[model samples]
Target chain A: MAQLTYREAIARGIAQEMRRDESVVFLGEDIAAAGGVFKGTVGLLEEFGPVRVRDTPISEQAILGAAMGAAMTGLRPIAEIMFADFFAVCWDIVVNEIAKSRYMTNGQMTFPLVIRSGNGGGLRFGAQHSQSVENWAMMVPGLKVVVPSTPLDVIGLMAASIRDNDPVIFLEEKALYATKGEVPDGDVVDTLGSAKVLRQGSNATLIALGNMVPRAQLAAEELASAGIDCTVVDVRSLVPLDTQTILREVSATGRMFTVEENPRLCGWGGELASIVADEIFYDLDGPIVRITTPHIPLPAADALEDLAIPSVTRIVETVQKSMNS
Target chain B: MSLDVVAPLLLDDKLDLYRSQFALRQFEKRAYDLFLENYVKGTSHLSIGQEAIAAGVARAMRPDDWTFATYRGHAHTLARGVPMAPVFAELMGRANGLMAGKGGSMHLTSVEHGVMGSYAIIGAHLPIACGAAWSAQYRGTDQVAVCFFGDGSTNIGAFHEALNFAAIWKLPVIFFCENNLWMEYTRTTEVTAVANPAADRASAYGLESIIVDGNDADEVYAVTAACVARARAGEGPSMIEAKTYRHGGHSRADPGKYRPDEEVAEWLAKDPIPRYHQRLLAEGASEAQLVEIERAVNEAVDVATEEAKAGAVPGEDLLMKDVWANGGAEWRN
Candidate 1:
């Protein structure tokens, strides 16, 4: 067994696929000789060489359009947008081109590509650089959205996305890069639409994704000491949502809550809440609560930003008070 | 290739060029007539007078090569050797359409014919063409990607990005611009910074500046052949500007009222089909030979129209069929 940081897992995950398949290529800004700005792809250039691991220009449209063309023509390409917020610069390619090509062409063209970007608030990167844009991708019909909460989940989900035939948006939690977790001895490949129940309880179910998963787990642990037993479920993928696991967990406890980092309006939580209410409305104790950031631009100031995002104390208190009512 | 001269072209080659332009001309006229009859539900863009570029370019390329077209793509689709029925059915929203009516007139795709797609958005296909060439380069293949766009595409950001990317990476791509004078209602020169959109920008990307008379089939063929050969030989990319004009308005809805009648008569006099027909007669090509080819092309259009008219509008089954590779649009268990 070995301990691997989330950043290390990203390179390993990409390297794992590049080793297995010659057609799997990687391209992005500052990713080749520079070892990536985030340093997640440090050794890929050395291993795969310059041909397979390419460094692109500041042209986001070129990077994505190239990936799309390559994917359509018998190659699996992974393009990086550098930051999730930059998706706005190339949303047409991602949504209009990549997402709808398969459907529009009547399955005549298939896109086996992965678009990876650093997501979420922390480290005070400001509003322009930091955004959890998984919801932006999830709202599209053809894209598969995946956000990894753990280091091992990174490798597993990355491998799954590269193998899947559709375009997958892999969002890496920016703050979780330095955090380390155990890496088992052999290869690890996970499913895209599966949710994991980290901690089980009978009182209620707390479903969270990406950066909010760890915070929700910590909140669940702290609340356990206060006699409020809550189940923490990590939603790994959003598009092919694991409604079975989510609804089952929420149904067993007859309560549900979503801890989201995206803005309140049109976040992944809002969609899940609607689904939960539609499917299992009678199997609830109280109204489903969504612990999320307010609908505003995230602050760059460290203290204010920390207060804006839902913290463990806030999650625990919100769940405790809601359960009591 | 001399200007408006076919001395270097063989008699059979001249006949083939005539057939290509004639087929496209007859097909477009029929499409416009169908729109008048209320058969075509949405809009269609007809490249009536721009047949020389399509004819010469498609004739010059290898059948295995890929083509990326724009929304004004009915000419490009037929140029790739796709039967007229599927394309017409696609425009008419029929079940037997090119994409099973999933993609209407603007997004016709025929992978079997190497017509990758007909992108509706302007300038989007330039980089995608670069990507296709990138794959061909990666796979160690000699296939070159030929991207066709209007003059308006030159001003888009993707156009600049793709040109720079193609130049830096030396990808095998040929960017062909059909300067049909009018980019939708306005003249291209009124809004453009440079007079020659595609050719003038070639210096910025370290490529040669080339422009040709698009009305001359022999001229476009010679230039396109050289560019394709250069791409296949791994000589990076070539940007070509073909100066042509659209005989009709931009799309089916437009009557082209903004154009002065004198300007319209000047272009209509230089219609590529009749000009090529006259050229074929002078090049030792018999009038009977061309008359038979035109007859065959007209018959082909007539047969395609009958078949497309016989098709049904796609049902709900096709509506949800192609959302994923698994042939289902289901997002959940």
Candidate 2:
């Protein structure tokens, strides 16, 4: 297991899939000759000709709609939207068309396509570029939502997404791209809907996703020093959430704190909190706590942006408060 | 204008082709009557005056080659050899329908017959056809895809994108637009600046375009045969603009009051069915023979209607059935 950055791991996974299947092709705004804005498709055009690594026009609607069409007709197309925020423009193709076609057609078709994009708030990209929108994707029935926090998870989950028969929204946090970890090489495929207990404890449970996973683990370690003994759960797939594992852990701890970078109003953290409260409310010794960004658009200033997102410090404070309460 | 090229499949017998056109016309007319009598569950966009376009293009396509169309698609589906009984049953929303009553009039599909699907969404199936063409070429099949849309579809972005992609990839597809001069209430003249939609746009994509008399089933069949042959021979995509008219409303409710009375009268006078029947008669078909064919089609349609009415409706419990290929959870991870 060699150390690889989350960005590298995603790139490597795409490369492996492209190499294995001739039908696998890549399409996005700058994925081809430019090797993607994030370089996730670096050297892909050279390895596979221009036909396989396709650069498309700026229309996200066209890019996604075409990919859906291609996938329906038997080609496994991996399309990238530059940012999750841009998914708004193509929501018709995503929600009405792609997500419903299989069910509407009575399973006469299968959309084995992967729509990969960067999400989450950080890097001072402002409101348009910086926003976590996995919650919107989770509401859709026929789509699979995958959020990988580490390099290993990115490599494993993306490989799984490409091989998946259904349409998968493989969301990569732009903030976690450069973060490195040991990614297992050669067929790093893992099952979807499985959450990993990064650090196990009994006093409290801290569930997080995407970039927030690392911060949650760090917070748990810090809480351990303060004698809190927190459990950290990485929610890899949001739609098919590992609710059983979460319920068991929450039952044991009787305290929970969920963290997410998206604004608090309709963040993914709220979903987890609601589920915990609804399912195991009687088991809780303390109120279910959540650490989320302020309910507002991400500001351009670094300091304001920092305040807009949940940090390790915020998670620690939220956990401490929940324990004390 | 004819390219004056060598024809891949010669038709020394235009009389046989005219017979197919007559059959299509008769089929649509009887189906419309059944629909009017309320035996058919879904509204059909009958191809009464557009028989030649469907029969001509579909006759040239092989079983392996794919075809797709819009909601106005009885001719396209029937011409592609989707048996008249199942087609009737499908329009009637019967359980034994081609899509098992899941897809009503606007959405007919039969994988076995190579009729990819029919979309109610205008211009949407063009890209889908390109994708199917890509699949065919990838699988090393000489099969091509024929995508049928309307004159109004040319204004949609999907139509342009599909053509550009098909041209760039050199996918074996034929973009056939039935320029019937009307998009429900709007005329083609009000929408596009170009006189000929298909041929005008073909030069933009480096594709060869042919404009044919869509009312002449023989002309449509002859032109489509040459185009499909060229595509199967590895010469990229082509476009065929079949100039025709929908002699009925776009759908069931519309009165089609927008079209000029004189124009409608002119098109109705030269209806494809009678024109083809006259041609067949001129080519030595006896009056009794023509009448016999008409009787056979009417009887077949009647049986189809009776069978469809007798068939059971899909169970309520089966509402969530076939949501996905496997019995996995309806929600994806």
Candidate 3:
């Protein structure tokens, strides 16, 4: 195993895939010389050359449309939309063309493209740059959504997403880029729809997604100190959700609390809560609780932004309330 | 401009282009008839007066060259040698359709025939064609890509982005803008800033641009042939603006009251089919041969319509299939 940061693991995963498959190419704005604004694709242009690692103009629609066309031909293009919030500009191509092409063409074509974007709110980038929109992607039918929390999961899931025979929206938390962890040495591939149980406990099940996993872990640690033991489950893939793992955990611990950084209304957390309520209503000891961002645009102020996003304290408080009820 | 400027055509090639143009006209007329009789469902945008461009462009392209068309693509696909049966079946939503009824009139694709797809959204497929050309260039193949869109598409951001990208990369692509003078109901002049959109924008992207009479099959063929040669020789992308007109409404519902009577009549007089036929007759081809071609086309379209009607409607099971190539195993239990 090698210790690597979240960003390093992502870049290494892409490099490994590019070395494995000649058809794999990376395209985005400033991804080559600048190595991406967040350094998620550093050293790729030097290693793979300009043909493979392209620095495209600031055209998100063309970036995705070209990626779709390239995928239709014979290239596995990993397109990076600078931020998740910018998806609005290219949503028509993503939703109408890329996601619907396979099904619309009756399986005659396969889109092995990955759209990587920086998601979650923590850098005080305000409403435009600091919004998590994984739920918008999860609502699409043919897309696979992945949000990795740790460096190990990021490497494994990024490799799997690139190799998979479908379009995947790989959401990387901007706040977790410098966070370090021990990633396996080589060729680590994770199953798309499987969730990982970071810490097992019996009092209540705390399910988190993307950056919420670390916050949930912290919340679990605090709950453990107070003798309110909780199991922390990282829901890696949102579309092909690990429903079986969630149900199993909920069955073991009669309480459930879901956490996310997106808005509370109609977000992914609501979908999880609905699934748990519908499938395991009889097994639940109390009502399902979701600790998520309020249904308001993220403000630039640090205090307001902190209040708007979900934190460890909020998760712990939600878990305490669910446990007591 | 007089029709005398058109170069003389070989007897066989002239007859072939005439047959293809006639077949497209017959197909669109029959499709509209079927739609009015309630046999065909949904809306269809017919390329009635614009058949010459499709026939000419298809004739100029090699079988290996890729072609992307807009939503008004029946003529484009048919001219590329996709038979009338599957085309009719697709419009009717039958199981034997090109896309097996999933893609209706707006989205038709046949990879084997090099017809990449017919996009419903305007200006969306421009970059897609550039990507295909990029793929060909990256793989070291001499194959080129041709994208067909309306004059209105040139005003969109995708057109600029795709052209600029192709220019910088020197990708082998031809941007064929069938400037039919209107976008839906509005005149192109009212909405667009430039009088000649393709010619005005080509220099901005460092691409060579040409203006051709889209109603003249021979002219369109000649210009597209030159552009194809330039692309194959690695001279980068070119924009060919084929000025034509649509004889019918934007869709089936409109009566075309938006267009002035004089304007419509002026373009109608330039109807490519009869003009080419007159030229053929003047070249000493017998009228009997033209009649025979028309009869053959009519018979073929009749058989295709019958076969399309006889084809099955997709079953309920088809709704759940093909969402993913791996059968969406992760989503299912």
Misplaced by over 4 Å in model 3 are B1-9, B328-332
Measured on C-alpha atoms, candidate 2 has an lDDT of 0.81
Per-candidate TM equals 0.98, 0.90, 0.97
Candidate 3 global lDDT: 0.89
Q: Give the interface RMSD values of the models in order.
A: 0.8, 2.8, 1.4
Q: Give the distance in Å from residue A136's predicted Cα in candidate 3 to where it truly belongs.
A: 1.0
Q: Alpha-carbon error at B127 in model 3, in Å? A: 1.0
lDDT of 3 by residue, B244-280 (tens): 9999999888878999999999999999999989998
Residue-level error in angstroms, candidate 2, position A263: 4.5
Q: What 10-residue stretch in candidate 1 chain B is worst by lDDT?
A: B1-10
> Candidate 1 on B133-193: residue-level lDDT in tens?
9999999999999999999999999999999999999999999999987888888889999
Which one is best on lDDT?
1
Chain A TM-score values, per prediction: 0.99, 0.97, 0.98
How is the predicted docking of candidate 3 categorized under the CAPRI scheme? medium
Best by TM-score: 1
The predicted structure with the larger lDDT, 2 or 3, is 3
Error of 3 at B193 (Å): 0.8
The sequence of per-residue lDDT tens digits that candidate 2 reaches over residues A1-325 is 7998888887888888888888898888888899889877788889988878888767676677668767877889898999999998777678867877776555677889999998977889889998899988887778889999988888788888898888999999999988999876577888888988888898988888988998888888899999999888888998667888888888988888888877777777787788788888999988877788877889989999987788888888878876876
Task: Score chain B of candidate 3 by TM-score.
Answer: 0.96
